[model samples]
Target: MLKKILFALIMSVFFIGIVSGCSESSDKEEGKGSGKQTVKIGYFPNLTHSATIIALEKGFFEEEFGKDVTIETKTVANGGLFMEAMATKAIDVGTTGPGPLLNFYVKNKEYHLISGAVNGGAVLVSAGSSKISDLKDLDGKKVAIPVIGSTQDVMLRKALKDVGLKPTTNGGSVELFASAPADTAALFVQKQVDAAATQEPWGYVLENQAKGKLLLNWDEFAWGKDSPNTVVAASQNFLDKKGFSASYLKAHKKAVDFIQNNPEESQELVIKHLKELTGKELSKEEVAAAFSRLEVTTNVNEEVIQEMADISKEAGYIPSADIKGLIDLSTLEEVSK
Candidate 1:
């Protein structure tokens, strides 16, 4: 059984004030005048990560971190790369999918899942001209995923298992190809891959621009809306920074609120941010559709996170499935009291 905590907007407001307040006090006490501490952040250039994007665009993180902290960022192409950056201490904390976080955590045990970023932005899509209409039609087809052990890859594998089919890694008909989500659209257009288990707005882009058809939408896929797609992960060092993790979540909560309360403005901000980050502009319709597909929240389903960890372990991507102490939401819990 997973522990579920669905935080309300007003409850989050209370949580943020309590958490960030502690972080501020701790920093002041460290008044050794060590100057400024730099916080290295990482995130994918995907709408699944719109909260983080909106935070950066709106200066939420800067506002929360205050004048004593220096913020640096890196745009990761996929969750695998994002975790890798965390491993090398290149990224102190940032947003990434649950799959890669668990896959990396099993072996590294170096990450603390601080908050949930988004849920259900992944979709299963096939070529528009292809005869495949659903998961059952995926036999003998080529599927493109962001990476071998990515969140979408795990979802695709689970869905395939349900259909009594498997990717070639398990000697099944479907062959899995690892590609960056941004580049998967070309493969879909060139007819190079039969389908993709990808995150938005690439899923949206593939449909509108590459004639890709959605076989399963975000809410209809493997775990459906229950899937915990994106989460805020903190490196070991970051968590050790007294109340830093709590402070980061304060900004995270603000971003989640901004997205939920001002979705229309969020879509435009996402459009501008993605364009600036990737130089690949997306239409408003696609961005809007993509934005609507996922749920932005700070609450996580621990059972779903556990199941994802198990799936990765079964897929031979991780050494073990025991991710004890993987999630530390005590900061949020404490402040609420």
Candidate 2:
């Protein structure tokens, strides 16, 4: 009886050891699979940031991570708020125009232009009763922008000045105000505002449904056809961590591939996702037109980014002295996957 009892105890201990070894191996596999870090991404629902929406729908992030990961989304009421979030490290990555990024950098904050999000989607629209048929006609008009320090605001200021009109002066030639993009479009429709410089899908909505006419689609005014309207940015700290940024860049590359390869399918997905998040579907025409106006490329055009910086500087959004060292694009070169 004593021998049988001892034998049973020995077998139980051996089984437990095997189970322990399997658990450790399983954990290591999971660690290798899931990546050593988590990524929190921030993006807007507007067409300016359609790439992010399409990316999420297509499972690009998941493919890159090779395991379960967490993805977070937040809506920035304006570019100022977005920059504030970046400064505080509330998000690891974000998508927006270069204007805000440059401005933030000038203020001594650091961020990396990790990848490209979308190209052009910006447009200038005038209310039906407004006499603005071109940039030349924008003289002496009140314009609405999503925010004072936003990319649209900077672009509008530059476009106006390009036409020989001063935005802040020249006999009150231009009055620019800040409001949400959708709200600005509604105000344009109500005739409370003469025009608005806005990014896509919003530009599409205003033109098609609100009786606004397009003064300039993206190509005509800002970066011309292939300009990088939105870029993927990351905190410097996030970039310094091992393998985290690589995983993010890999995911971003997949997103670019998915967008370029499957635009039509991506558009459908964007509409569905946008509606779920925003409570409305972008019209088929809007999606089609907006997509046409945008190029989904990961190259952050240095010239265009510099132009955005110059615009912000000249417009008094950022001091001219700070423009030179505003960009920390080194990481851009690092993660150009």
Candidate 3:
């Protein structure tokens, strides 16, 4: 009787050990699925990307993503690098220009414009000494763009087209310089470029720091307020994560609301964030000035984006502008609803 009792105890102990081991293994597998992971986001350090800035600074992403996920951010000087990072899977979701996103989407359908960020925060400025009083003056002068084929570049091309001028790349007289916006100011000070197509507060910076003159205001620029300057983009794999899109868009919408509802505070926040990112302390003047030209909203106009794509194709940036599946706002619609 003692031996039988001892054998029963041993069997029970072994079964419990197996069950405990299985539970632990299952837990580890679950962890691999969603327990802990790092999410990488990318954006340019421009006012046009303020939604991303505010989202990060205000901790909206943290609140939505929770404690289990880590948020990693990468800031690029130009849209070309931003899209390049997306292509290499360096970033999961963040903000970028509609033009760069569309141009890249045409070549590689690996990403989608999840939502609209900010619209019409860009302008065309001529150096104070360049004697470029109007668009036609750009015909024989050098123009700086954030990047070749960027949103600003496309806008510059359009403006040039209106004036019967074109970038040398397009077989016209205007000389195009592909420079980072931050560096474009130095180009102006050095007389390296006569004009620049850029977004604020860089436009404000050019006006103040480099004595740049605004040749075309935001509304006067291509598509004006209808132009999709900054937009939310996401890699396909990241969008595939369960509930990730909803969480991200929730944070994005929250940030946009903050920017809209709290105007003065939002301006200061942008100034502080810009200083932190660029090491340049911007005044309320430029921040407010940039804010004036910008419309922060979650509404993305597909018709405007389609127009941008058409302009891109006309400029030979892409073979065709058929971005049929480039925009998948189903998640955004669901989240908004």
Q: Top model by lDDT, which number?
A: 3
TM-score between candidate 1 and the true structure: 0.87
Model 2 clash pairs? 140-173
- The root-mean-square deviation over C-alpha atoms between each candidate and the true structure, in angstroms, is 14.4, 6.5, 4.4
**Tens digits of per-residue lDDT for model 1 on 1-337?**
1233444666788999998888877776554345678888999887888988999999988988888888899998888899889999889999998888888788877798988889998899898867689798899988998888888999999899889998888778888998888788788778898899989888888888889899999998888888888999999888899878877888888889999999999999998998998798888888888878999988888988888888788788888899998998887665434
lDDT for every model?
A: 0.86, 0.75, 0.88
The weakest ten consecutive residues by lDDT in model 2 span: 29-38
Worst 10 residues of 3 by lDDT: 28-37
Q: Where does candidate 3 stray beyond 4 Å?
A: 1-34
Could you estimate the TM-score for every candidate?
Answer: 0.87, 0.83, 0.87
Error of 3 at 39 (Å): 1.9
